[model samples]
Target: MTFAKLRVRAMMVALLLSIFAVGGRGVSAQTNAYATAFTTSITYQNIGTGTANINLTVYSSSGTPSAIPASTLAQNGAGSYFVGSVSGLGTTFNGSAVISADQPIAATLVQIPAAASQVKNRPLSNGFSSGSDVVLIPTVLKSFANYTSKFVIQNTDSVANDFTVQFINPANGAVVHTANPANVLPNTSVYYDAGTIAALTGTFNGSVKVTAVKTGTTNPGSAVGTALELQTNGVGAYASQAFPASAAATKVFMATSLCNLVIPSGATTTFYAVQNAGTASASVTVTYVGTAGSTPVNVTSTATTIAAGAKASFNPCGLAPNGFSGSATINSTQPILAIGKVSGAGLYTAFEGATAGSAKTALPYVRWLAPAQGGQQTFIAIQNVGTTAATNVTVKYYSGSGTLLGTHTIPSIAAGAKASSNPTSASPSAAGMGVGGGSAVVEGTGAQLIVVTRVTSPVTGGTTGEDYNGIPFN
Candidate 1:
């Protein structure tokens, strides 16, 4: 603690402080140095039947004298296209690597139309044929794990073709997978997986949709293409299934958690909730929203719970009170969740027969068209596009003119048949047709329709066909 020693220490501390102030700023600048950027390009071309070629490359910015070399690139085939990434840059990138592809070089596009056509929706048949820019979905229901769906896209083109498969949750219309699109060649079918797809789309959904866009390529063209849709439904924890209990107290079933039965966007999908292997006392709560059916339907007493090691069947449509629809989440503290669906009717009818009442349900694709001006007439058409017959098909209309016209229910419609009617009277009205004029609107001020269709199928668990049309008034 000498005064001389203290003075020396202060001098050293001041000198070190000055050096830190000078060096700290210089270190910060070096660490914060900016890096150059680059870009990428991809293209696809269909040469002929079942064949497509793809080309993907990366290029650095023209502003830089020496761009990132093309050799520092890696490429992989996705659904119908190819994806590329660069490495060894040693820093985060300002310019992202560009990824592009041609539709021809991508995977095939498949369309699953409403299951109205007997031939199209029938069991075990080539659903539809494919042509240039036309994609057909085979009438097959496949499952994948973790709500991840997988399918094979067949390229019936002549040249090497590429494709891009996108996964979408039809239940809520969400995109799940995007596999950088891909390239298919003559006589080759690309088997796409969830990993590649998730990388491309940056997310995943319950069901997947494969879209084969032609990437950039020379002489890209397509002759025939198609994609498959798949879904695992949901995680096991999100679902519950069991036979009915012996006693009334045991009737209540608990699901591990709330389950979500999702459908992809732009997808025509169906879901079935069945009361399997239970007695008449077996019941469940089904909750859901959308055009599938009436929301918050309860499935009760339709299932027969077996005594001890016995089994029985319960149908939601046969429940005590009917005409209800929706999906249920097992949120009750008592914990009673409906069993997993086992090949039954649509959302509403799924619980019918198990209960006792008129089980009226709505159609998923049913919606209203835009409203018409005075003297203008709107035509709402219901087309039976499913495989099975439809019963009690109904279409309710509303006037955007701030009037409720009531509802109209159709008795039935055969497959491939089109039913069209003017929302209002076929004749024009002075200030537009009055309420109950066959014209109506849904939730908002715009014109809308409430559609309902009961499926009639020879098989116990077959689905009905569907189609829709909206005619706007002048």
Candidate 2:
């Protein structure tokens, strides 16, 4: 395996469709204040046969470009499924997008943060798979107070590139900051504003190991081709997080749908930031799954190493008890990477756990429109890393022009276990499924289960969030 280690092991086993935008809203807030505005959705699926219309192009990250739009995906007769959304595109702007279809396609490009009331709906999942070079962005920040992170790079190769954006320091990997913004012309895309970098400009919190090399080969070839991480709390509107080519993971699934009984700390407390990215030093095991009689604790701290690439953030309710809510599964002998943040009452969801539970059958087609349930109210969590129990487990619901809104069967799910509900409390809402919103697909014939999709919103001390971990479709 050489050719950039087989494209970094085929981009650590697939996922990353290329996208970046600042779109509408004066870009520049989050430290001195509030800045939010970014939404890029480009979904595709058309094996081949009947109808077809796909051609989307947008570039800027330094490759500056624009012009080419022809959406019309309406052919589910044999191979169909087309989603579109690429208007204007301005704001902080730093882009790269290309979608041309003749048939054979299965794409995804998502980025959220367009609405606001208080702003608390963070969902990010970026990638670069097809045999990699360098794309391992576990988490990068600059918290001196709340939070501030924004590092976008897009060269998804076709030619020109010259990358290198280090920024390590996960506890002691060194490299405070490094830059080279302005030589990414392939599909085009570039942006680095860790809240206005000044070689870190002060209190630097990090982890961003990009490497697009291979134009002349010094090894890390292929000149860094993908990365999109947008963190925020400085004031809201910066959603998108999921850039892991190989942070390693033996198992991880710590999700919560807020069982509120007063657990406030900053949105509700349920964080589990575990990042090892291996090289040696790992050792962990925390299991906490409650409700069905509750009793599966194990995790009083002590017995958690993590130190290779470094990163730690715990509070899984200490692994159950004190107002314990639900969901927990972290097992690592080494090969680790996790993320789970669930804010308090006003609501705010943060997700990216289950580095191996597998994102919704691995990209099991899920669409959102009709406001994805209008004000927002979507829940679905299924964990069963398998050791046994997993009776039937199937969640199928659709609506939003696709219509089908039905099917929901989750009888058992023990083994390592987990099962959050919402479809009128897990199977019952009949043909209206979750009521509004739209799109879903979670299967199980044998059972290994791993699905996640939250999405609350109402504000004023009620709800507010956005979650994800269900993208697996090759």
Candidate 3:
């Protein structure tokens, strides 16, 4: 398997189509502070088939960007907004880059801000509204040992920007380093600290892509937007938790290749096994037992086939199943959400706290959008009310009074899929409460998941937010 591992498995189907595109925005007020630096002037007119009308104007770099007149700013069908939601301008900006497939295209942009601006200044942003197949990787990574690790890349755009680092070598895709236009100044995030670049002594597994470009676009729009090579061997997880199945398959939930997750052996020692593929092709197998359920020797395998509402993963290394004695049986019919990634050999550990009322029901985490650290961070809105797809789901955060703060795990979501997360690094203290307080029941033997929680209170004027349909809240 080479060709960059078959283009990293065909780029995981465009990373599940940008997580089934609804638009992302999570993590509010974490406070890294890169304030005051406006002068955003965007203009792109293509207006026809796949469409493109975009027009933006923001000054303050010195002011006079024409005094700020893009027709007062507020057009609808192509792209024009003074503010609608770019969420705190910390950056999430996504893309699809199409401009001519038939009509109605719009990778992103929906403004309205100017009422003195304050959802952290409101500039709002979106470039591939659904067009520009944005993929630009300008690498420079360097860490095979001194290890401190952070190098993240997920600015699914809603303001705050800066992500340009390319280094491709998924084993022969080769590119090495080619992302030199760095400036994620808007939404706020860009990472560094593997000692500071330059290490990997030998065998080299290569893979590095940290893209989010739209500062002056000279064209970095397709070929899946190239750049994804930063592999040491790959596989690093711990942000998946969701287990709830027994309400007689919650209403109507399809997706059953087989499902199981018992793990009842004297309580915590080592546990993690998640496999979700809610039906389309069906392929499942996972087992581990000790408390009398029997089946031990420990195993791991991850085939694939869950198109109804896709998600897949099978992990086992801690050991305790060659014959078994207590409990852990997951036969299959579709439904497996287990979590306990906790290992940080290369690094990325944080979040292993909330179970608060844990009776046990799948809880997944790994859906992020960062850059807020003031309100104390607390947002949860994993809405996919269930008609079919709700694979590996888990979203837990609190503040309004319940106060939990941390937990996110998402793998599959399609049916009605809505997204939002704030596993708290900081910024939200709490808002209206309701979302079942902090929400995280998500069951699936057959199915169940329809979470909600929107808290944003770092004070200032204290109110929080919500958007609906297109999905947005902080």
Candidate 4:
């Protein structure tokens, strides 16, 4: 990949880190229930062929910056760092960050709440490489089922800009409310709470679109953002990066979907929200492909229609058999964006669907711990989206210092099929991998693949967890 592409990918990773660094409060200090503190662990893998020297510049919400010590990683290796443990940033610190690397890398950030808070939710998001003038958020809520949504938008350009947020009703093509345009400083972020919007009264579930424009002109400006849905009465939370207009597609793929999959904590199910991004109404269909047995069982959604700027949702809970685990593909007549949420027994996670697959993908966080041990463990689901079956699919695990831990292989994966791996059962297990977290890279020879990873807290009978999309090496 060219230097520009690498930088774009790395920037995406940095965008996510900045989100939590600022506590999603922009220039102000996070407060009250929103003030829940978290320590962050960042995992990054060098996707380039050469060694990488990575540096981070953390910017406080006030725009003051602190330079973090540099770290190095070998080709295809991975490394990690703890943001809260770093010195110099006093307590109550909140801000944005920028990452610079000599070689291409993919990164993810995991936010763990302080023990005192007893918050089990472990929310995560992948880095964003670039920004856009317009962004789409597939799902947003306002006092709906005791849940609400919040978003933080960062201006990626060197100049200040004004952003307009429009909440669109999914049932009809209408703008329920439009928040007053907010002006944000360059390289800084601003937060919006749906609960605070009086126009968005009780029980509202819909989609959101944000547009950034030059401070004094109608010309488009650059920005990136992330949104989170929080359970008002509990600790449940899930996050997803806002989708740029360019990310909308006629088709989208989700690597993993659960339909009443019984786990220690509870039965799991996945629901998807598809937003119509085009000017015209959209005709959509969702196809679920089961991966549980020898033969694949396919289920399709009824003909659904969504008005422009609106969103439609469907779940496999009642459509698929109990204990069903599978993948989903969404087809639409109009360009659309999609996001999936997996929920059950206190576990909540949201991930953006893939508009396209890559030959290789990077997973920045992977963990493993025995069920009885009671800690976080990760389950990875990879889908072969290529025309032909994928063969010689391999995953390489690397330690925080870039040391090769071990490799796991999936001999062959038929096209449109899925495969999975669990670090707890890794072959030729590497020391410390099961107890300590690491990073990994998945490669599918001459085939395209997409990946989604689920991290469950407490190993088994976990009450909270999160999911994130694997970074593709463009």
Candidate 5:
């Protein structure tokens, strides 16, 4: 039997559980000072044949262990686990988790703040299948636009390792700050708050690169990381995973983007940052592909040269119409990495762009909660990147226990174009998920597909939303 391993960082069962109050406010960890309490949920899907037996082993910040017994899932099926509900995990757990499965699987993590806090941010991130010696974080802010950033790096190697983090100013490609966090234990994680870095003074927005080295040897160690950007005023937050250096490519695809799109709550817009990962300066161009009925537009960066290891920002405000909503393809003269951020209706979210697409994708979490129950809904965007039009595109929804709920077929999607589906809408499968949550799998016959999942709160003008990139089955 073959096994696949995935790692999830900052897997808190109930962060600061001891200090949290039942109905009122309480203080959380330093990483989330404004949050009253933090709970975590992990959703996973089986992408391989036969039944998948998944085992989870969590390691506390101090390297303590807790095990979750194996659970089984059928091929293409999905399931979820609320960390706090697990008997072995216990409350007040702050740690990282490793998932092992007999078959290939994809998982996503959701960190939710308690309702009493009135901070409706649900930060979402995908599990890392493997670690890299070098990782790139496209965006990091320190007191920039009233938002601050924090990141967690996990040591995936068997032994302790030291990681050197460098913050680079995108303007002149200078290293503004460097931090070396020493001796991070195996399977454990370390946290860093950009706001605490004195060197990154007032209003700083930059990119970050982390290099891992073995504690006592000259050899490089393996590591993975995730970052969260939160509003200092406690309004919203979003999370994104770092990209391995090897993941950078000349072409990147963002499945969802908006240009001042007007919705019931407010106007939504998408802004993205592209980082040149090569040694030489490069030029970048962004091409927007609107949904079926809209026009396509290409916008090239005015700053012709983006220095190596530096980043450039772009938005559709001036290039596309106000109501434009669609996908984007980024092309660069050298290898590049990109991440997209969406803000509107008192909500903020982020997702990483894909360097490649797959014929099958997995969305580990989808929900439809009524207004009385937080009114959370999920929207899935599927982009066809193949040369030919995509046909027989289908979405399969499954219950939390791996039961097949329903399947919905989408109309043919044109190459470079995208289609969206709301599981709670007209689809029968969506109806099967009434007032609850589940998982979904998207497959396209003879087509390359890239997916993004966005979860929104029902309350209008409420600061509550999050998004994560779909996991492709390579």
Candidate 6:
């Protein structure tokens, strides 16, 4: 071997390393999950004809029972109850809750970041589901610049359990960072701050796979019950179901409304992230339902193919180009799971796909009022996803205390059509209605109507708005 040849090879290796900056700086892989403090708000709506007796249970990160609180709510009509209203939860308390109702009820637990004093922020929302050993987080962003996710995982089991999270890059189907945020004791909740974590500091955007293994076993099959939440940049998203499950459906229905032709500056849109969790690649078709007025309008997206191990994001309004505000249904050639983020007018909600003809779509609680200092307003949007037309459908407005204040009933809604109402203008204040407390419930007979809500603050000058989804009583 010649010394001159060896010198040439060493010089080439050094040149490549310098070009890629592969010498000293390295990306960190986040490992070990820890509990970080966050603000949580729990809201529940009574769907029964009568009042509901609700029981609340709280658990800490170590899987210990936190507290037991009980409250009985009776009002003029349908309304909401914050768990802290009857419990000892502080304004900044962080934990998990389980609400049980004597009568039929619907509820959600929301974790809010420190909201701007004069503006609104996106809050992570989740509707409680039963025991599961695994959770699939469809979307996450950390290396995307000013985009990071605060992820929460809680145990629903009564006994201690072990948990692990694998952050994967969707583009290449590679596990980017693996972290064990500590084991979960029974009934406890844990949090992970991706922005501050050293292991997850490297730039990457994709999905999360969370598994809760049994406390004493290393088997992946020994998963206990678990729940999850993820939030970033004033927007939140949640997994509707945890386990590796699939629906054998060809179509999925989503109720939507209002796509501003010129999207506002810093305006995040309503979008769906379709993840093909299956092994074989799949193809999907997306179609929108426009409002039926003096003129009929419709919009659709080109058929898309999602790789077997990857996912895609879609903004329906941007698919073709239309200002139509209404409903949408996605059809696929193979099985798929969809996680939707609906945002416009400063509000966002994590949406779970539903089957067609499945609603008495009602947003159990909404707020609208004009006060001297500030104001609160609400927009209720319902989309009829059924084949049959929805007729004589009504959005019944009520005071937060349960008194029916006013009503706005539309004459008819065609199949795939949507109807929206602003209670502040359309429905005047009625009996016992206060200034800031507002509530609403939807009713109709034939086809199911999908309902989603938008609530804004400072009612008059404030720019903050938050979106809440309606309860579809099965």
Task: Tell me, by TM-score, which candidate is best.
Answer: 5
Q: For each of the candidates, give the backbone clash count.
A: 131, 28, 119, 8, 0, 11
Q: What is the clash count of model 4? A: 8
- Residue clash pairs of candidate 5: none
The best-first sequence of candidates by TM-score reads 5, 4, 6, 2, 1, 3
Off by over 4 Å in 6: 1-38, 75-93, 110-119, 122-124, 180-183, 197-201, 217-249, 257-259, 262-268, 291-296, 342-350, 371-373, 424-438, 458-462
lDDT of 6 at 355: 54
Candidate 5 Cα outliers beyond 4 Å, as residue runs? 1-14, 19-37, 85-94, 291-303, 424-427, 434-436, 460-463
List TM-score per model, in order.
0.25, 0.34, 0.22, 0.89, 0.90, 0.75
Local distance difference test scores for all models: 0.26, 0.53, 0.28, 0.76, 0.78, 0.54
Model 2: per-residue Cα lDDT over 198-221, one tens digit each: 787676766776667645545443
Give lDDT tens digits, candidate 5, residues 86-113. 5544446566788888888888888777
Cα lDDT tens digits, model 1, 291-341, are: 223344333332323221111222334332233323222112221212223
Clashes of 2: 28
User: What lDDT tens digits, residue by residue, belong to model 3 across residues 63-143?
Assistant: 122122222211112122222222322232222112222223223211211222232321112232321223322122243
Candidate 1, poorest ten consecutive residues by summed lDDT: 6-15
- After superposition, the stretches of candidate 1 with alpha carbons farther than 4 Å from their true spots are 1-127, 134-146, 167-177, 180-183, 195-203, 206-220, 223-474
**RMSD of each candidate?**
26.5, 20.3, 22.4, 4.5, 3.2, 14.7
Which residue segments of model 4 deviate by more than 4 Å? 1-35, 85-94, 180-183, 291-295, 370-374, 434-436, 459-463
What shift in Å separates residue 167 of candidate 4 from its native position after superposition? Answer: 1.6
Decoy 4 TM-score against native: 0.89
lDDT of 2 at 362: 30
